[model samples]
Target: MIWSLIILCGVITFLIRFVPLSGIISSDLPLSVKQSFKYIPLAVLTPIIVSDLSIMENKNFFIIDNFKLYAALIATLAALIWNNVLATISIGMASFLIMSNF
Candidate 1:
């Protein structure tokens, strides 16, 4: 049973990593379809950012009293001003930690 589970996991992992890079499935895609891949990062990040800014209380989404939302906005402004990834991440994390604590 354990070996079968390991083999199943390995096959799933291989398929996940291989299907995108194999080029076998992308050969016949339209030009627009190929170009749309450029938005993949943005598509992935939007939900993450939104979820981080919202607070779940009593099974409801609440924006009020969410310090994370304000901290993220401040960090975004800092990133725009600094234009540095490290600085942006540092500012974001620091703001998040400070806000979470108090």
Candidate 2:
């Protein structure tokens, strides 16, 4: 019963999200709407980044011992420099492994 409820909720959520997008993309959107949509990616990403950065268990903001943070930062720099996901992930994993050991 719980599983069925969960599945039903997921389907409803997906339909609610997709139906509008399907309509918008299928038909020609207005110029104003298209222009407004250009900021959507940044708007979505900014809050996520801020939320991740702000949420922490300890008082120290740096969290120097957290290997995941180091890995993610290194990965972000690598991605910026190389423009490659594989390289970024490899660098991140290597950093994580090195940090975890020490």
Candidate 3:
């Protein structure tokens, strides 16, 4: 049963990926479509980061922490200024680790 489920998932993944690359759909998209797709990463990551940064307790829910949120902010700045993936991730992770230790 597990093997069958794995095979099914693999097939589904293959179909999802393959259908996009195939000629069944038009490759040329409008400027609006491209612009919206470009913001997909930010749209997806913002909520997750905000949730992690926020403090949630029985009495208080609005408190912001020191480590993860600041690290993420610095990382975001690094990415914007440097436009480099490796540097952004390194700065983000390093800051997170360092701040977490304190």
Candidate 4:
């Protein structure tokens, strides 16, 4: 089952790239299409990140000492300051681990 799911995902991913880049859809995608695709990462990531902030450990974000929320804030700051993906992720995960152990 897992193998089939993986294969299906790979095939779908390949087609998403191939159909556009291969010119089957268009040789030059419109400016609008390109701009929309840029937001795809944010659209995909926001909910996944929000779940940790809101519902992780069965607690609300406003509750005191929510480590995931703190970690996310740290990660957001790191991203804004350093603009480095590796640094943001490392700091976020590290802070979460440390705070959770406290």
Estimate every model's Cα lDDT from 0 to 1.
Answer: 0.84, 0.81, 0.85, 0.86
**Tens-place lDDT digits, model 3, residues 29-95:** 8889878987988899888877777655455775456577789888999999999999999999999
User: Over the full model, what C-alpha lDDT does candidate 4 score relative to the true structure?
Assistant: 0.86
Off by over 4 Å in 2: 1-28, 45-55, 58-62
Query: Which candidate has the highest TM-score of all?
Result: 4
Superposed model 3: Cα runs more than 4 Å off: 1-13, 26-35, 54-59, 62-64
Q: What count of clashes does model 1 give?
A: 0
Candidate 1, residues 1-102, lDDT tens digits: the string is 999999999999899689879976765779898799899889999888887667676789777778788778888998899999888888988988898898
Residue 39 displacement in candidate 4 (angstroms): 1.3
Candidate with top lDDT is: 4
lDDT of 4 by residue, 63-82 (tens): 47778888999999999999
Order by TM-score, highest first: 4, 1, 3, 2
Clash pairs for candidate 2:
none
After TM-score superposition, the amount by which residue 82's alpha carbon in candidate 2 deviates from its true location, in angstroms, is: 1.1
TM-score of each: 0.60, 0.55, 0.58, 0.77
**TM-score of model 2 vs. true structure:** 0.55
The sequence of per-residue lDDT tens digits that candidate 2 reaches over residues 13-96 is 899689877775555768898799879889999788645644365664756676777778888999899999799989988998
Steric collisions counted per model: 0, 0, 0, 0
What lDDT is reached at residue 60 by model 4? Answer: 33
